[model samples]
Target: MNRLAYQYVVLRCVPRVDREEFLNVGVVVYCQAADYLQVAWQVADDRLRALHPALDVDQVRDALGFIEGVCAGDGRGGAAAGHPVGQRFGFLKAPKSTVIQPGPVHGGVTTDPAAQLQHLLGCLVG
Candidate 1:
């Protein structure tokens, strides 16, 4: 079977960087052959509160929205959207100090990019 190239990273919510604690909250997948970059996220408010009771849910949700916007190439995506697919993926995979941060980038070959994205999300974030 023919296969396409794909890369992905898991997003984590780190309420306190000094504490070095985090919860897997989302996944970002990029399929270069398909020219697709999408983020799949399901924020568990309870989980966040469990880690840091004072954590703001709205802020976390908004961060997730920004990630989605970047994937959609919307105006809210800012300069990152104008970049090539690989560059955008690189931006997403970069580390951040905010509550939402990208994990390491993982690569694989898949016959179906969309299906592979869901599979990665289910396995890594869900």
Candidate 2:
């Protein structure tokens, strides 16, 4: 199989942006040729709580769910579904000031985006 170019971003949880502290919470990946755009996330509740004792897991969970919806183009995706794949990816990769933010965009080549996504999740967020 030909190697396909892919891009990914590590999703971070910044409970306090002023302190510039964060925890890796998830990964979003996109491969246009494979038409695969998805997110793999694992919220380490204990780790998160350690970072910010006052952090609410429920709110963080809701934010992760919204990202999943956007990746899947579900109704909860809001206006993301109306855009093309690249646009959707651009939207997700853009920086944000909220609790959830995307890290810098990174690139690689892969034969299987699904497997690559898992690898990234493990290496970057897990």
> Which candidate's TM-score is highest?
2
lDDT of 2 by residue, 3-102 (tens): 9999999999999899889999999999999888999999999998888999998899899898888889887788886677788899999989999999
Candidate 2, after superposition: displacement of residue 42 in Å? 0.4
What does the lDDT read for residue 43 in candidate 2? 94
Tens-digit lDDT track for model 1 on 1-126?
Answer: 879988899999999899999999999889988888999988889988999999998999899988887888887788888788778888999989888999888899999887887888788778
Cα error of candidate 1 at position 118, Å: 1.2
- Model 2: how far is 61 from its true place, Å? 1.1
As for model 1, its CA RMSD to the true structure in angstroms is: 1.1
Candidate 2 to native Cα RMSD, angstroms: 0.9
Model 2 misplaced stretches (Cα beyond 4 Å)? none
Error of 2 at 121 (Å): 0.7
Give the lDDT of residue 105 in candidate 1.
83
| Predicted structure 2, TM vs. truth | 0.96
